[model samples]
Target: MKVGYEFSKESCEDPVMKGELLLLSSVMFLLYVVSGCPERCHCHSFSKSVDCSQQGLVEIPSDLPPQTLTLHLQDNEIHQLPAFAFRSVPQLITLNLSNNSLSTLDPGAFHGLQHLKVLNLTQNSLHSLENRLFHSLPQLRELDLSSNNISHLPTSLDKPWENLTVFAVQQNQLQQLDRTLLESMPSVRLLFLKNNLWKCNCHLLGLKLWMEKFIYKGGVTDGITCASPDTWRGKDLLKIPHELYQPCPSPPDQVPSPAPQPGSARGAAPSLPEDRSALAECELKAKPRPANLRYAIATFIVTAVVCGIVGLMMLVATIYGCAYAAVTAQGHGGPLAPTNQPGKTAGKELLDSPAA
Candidate 1:
C-alpha cells in the first residue's frame, strides 16, 4: 500500500513540475528577446515588427532581429544610406523611412531585401536618386516619394519592374516629366502627381499625350495645374487642349538624300505610315464635328426664316398703315373738295396748305 501511494503521488507531481518548467521556459525566452532588442526601438518577435521612428537616428540601428518583417524608421535624422544597409534583413517586407532627412542613397542600398514590398521615402531631401538604387528590387510593389525635392528621375526607371504598382511623387519640384519615364512602370496602377512645376510648353506635348492615354486606359489621377508659361498656369493639365502645345517633330521616313530634284526635293522623300499619321496629327487637331456643323446650319436657317417673317410683316403693316391713312383722309374730306386749281390733287393742296 505504501509503494502504490508513493507511485501515485510521484506521477501527479511529475505533471505539475512539467507545467511549471514550461511556464519558466516561456518567461526566460521573453526576457531574452527583450534584452536582445535594439536600443531606442521596440521589437515584437511575435509580430516581427521593429519601430524605431522619431528617435533622431542618424543611421540604421544595428542588431535588428533577423526575422524582422516590418521596420518603421521614419522621422529620423538620417542623411545618407550606404549600400546594402539592409542586407541582413532578407525577409523585410515594409520599410517606412518617410519624413527622414535622407538626401542620397547608395546604388546598392537595397541589395538583399528581395522580399521587401513597400518603400516609403516621402518628405525627404532627395533631389535625385541613384539609378541602381531601385534597380533590382524584385518584390517591390509601392514606392512613395511625395513632398520631396526631386526635379528629375533616372532613365533606369524606364526599365520595367513587374510587381511595382503605386508610385506617388506628388508635391515635388518637377518642371517636366517624360512619358517614357512613366512608361517604365508598366504595372503601376496609381500615379499621384498633383502639385509640381509643370512647364507647359512644346516640351510638355509628350506629357499631354500620356495624360490622354492614361485617362483613356481608366487610370485615376487628380487634376495637375500648370505652374509656368503663364498661358497655361492654373489650368488643369488634362483639360488643356492638345492643340495648345506645339506638335512633336516627325521622324523622316527616309533620310532626305539628294537623289531628288531641287525645288520638289522635300516631297520626293517617301513617307512612312507613322510619318503620315504624325503629319495628320500635327494638323490642327481641332476637328470639325458634323453635329456642330448641323447645329450651325439649323440655327442659320431658323434665324433667316424668323427675320424674313419679321421683315414681311413690317412691310405689310407699313403699306396697310399708309393706305388706311390716305383713305381716312380722303373720306373725312367729304368727296375731295373740288380744287379751284386744275391738274392739282386736293390731297396735294391739303398737304401744301399750312394746317390743313
Candidate 2:
C-alpha cells in the first residue's frame, strides 16, 4: 500500500515538472522576441518617430518613450483592446489596426488618444461596432471600416465623430442603407459603398437615387449582382439610372406611393417588354449583316456546279460521237490506211529481188 502511494505521488510530480518546463520554454521564447525592445516598454523604434504598434503584446506595457508617433498594430492576434493602451503615446497620429483578430473594442479604447486623426480598422472580423467606441476621438477625420463582417451601420452613430470626412464601408454585408444613417453624418465627402450586397428593391430606392445624384456610386464591378429577385437579379446597379425606376400607380383608397424615392420615380411604369424590344431593335440595326459575302459564296457555288456539269456532258458527247463516227465509217467501208502502194509494196519488193 505504501509503495502504490509513493508511485502515485511520483506520477503527480512528473506532470508538475512537465508543466513547469512548458512555462519556462514559453518565457524563453518571449524573452527572445522582446530582447530588442525599445528603450521604453512594449515600444520598438525604427527612427525618432516610427514605432511598432502591436508586436505580440499581450497587454499594454508600462510606458512608451516620448518620441513614438505613428503606431502600426495591423495584422496581429489582439483579441481585446485595453482602455489605457495608448495613454502615454499621445503623439500618435495614425493608428492602423487592420487585419487583426480583434473581436471587441472596449468603450474606453481610445480614451487618451486626443491627437489621433486617421484610424484604419479595415479587414477585421468585427461583427458589430459600438456606437460610443469613437466618442473620445473627436479629431478623427478618416474612419475606414471596409472588409468587415458588419451587416449594417448603427443608426444611433449620428454624432459619434463630428469631423469625419471619409467614411469607407465597402465590402460589407449591408443590404440597404438607411437615410437616417446618412443624415447623422457631418457632411461626408468620400463615401465608399462598393462590393456590398445591396438589395436593389423599392425600399432601397432612396439610397440609389442619392448615389446617382452624388455620383458616389456603389458596386465595384458588374459582378456586384443583386441580392433580391422581386425586381433585380443579374443586374448591375452602380448609380440608379433615371429610366429604370418608374413608379407604379397607387389606388385611390391606398396611400400614395412614397413620393419619388432616391432610386425610384413618381411617374407611370413603362412596359419592360417595350424597353427590351426597343433595345433589341436598336442592337439589330446597329450591326450590319454579311449579306454580300453570302451572295458571293452562292454565286461561286452555282457557277462551279454549272461548269462541272457542262464539262461532263461535253466529255460524254465527244466519246459517244467518236464511237458513232467510227461505227458509221466501218459500216460504209473500212477507212483505208494512208499508204503509198500499201498492198503492192510487199509484192514490189519481191519483184525487185527477182530482178536483182
The candidate that achieves the highest lDDT relative to the unseen native structure: 1
| Model 2 lDDT, residue 46, Cα | 47
C-alpha positional error of residue 156 in candidate 1 after TM-score superposition, expressed in Å: 3.9
Per-residue alpha-carbon lDDT of model 2 for 262-283, expressed as tens digits?
6655585533343433332211
Report the error of model 1 at residue 301, Å.
19
Candidate 1 per-residue lDDT over residues 1-356, each given as its tens digit: 99999999999999999999999999968765754667799987678889999899999886788888999999999998988798666799999999989998898888889888999999999998766788768888999999999998775464436677888889999887877777777787788988998776666777778877887887777757888767667988777776556565554543343456566655666434554544333322333334677888999999999999999999999999998878987889655555576656755777788973
lDDT of each: 0.80, 0.67
For candidate 2, the 10 contiguous residues with the lowest summed lDDT are 278-287
TM-score: which candidate is best?
1
For model 1, the local distance difference test gives 0.80
Which residue pairs collide in model 1, if any?
A: none
The TM-score values for the models, in the order shown, are: 0.65, 0.50
- Provide the lDDT at 71 for model 2: 67
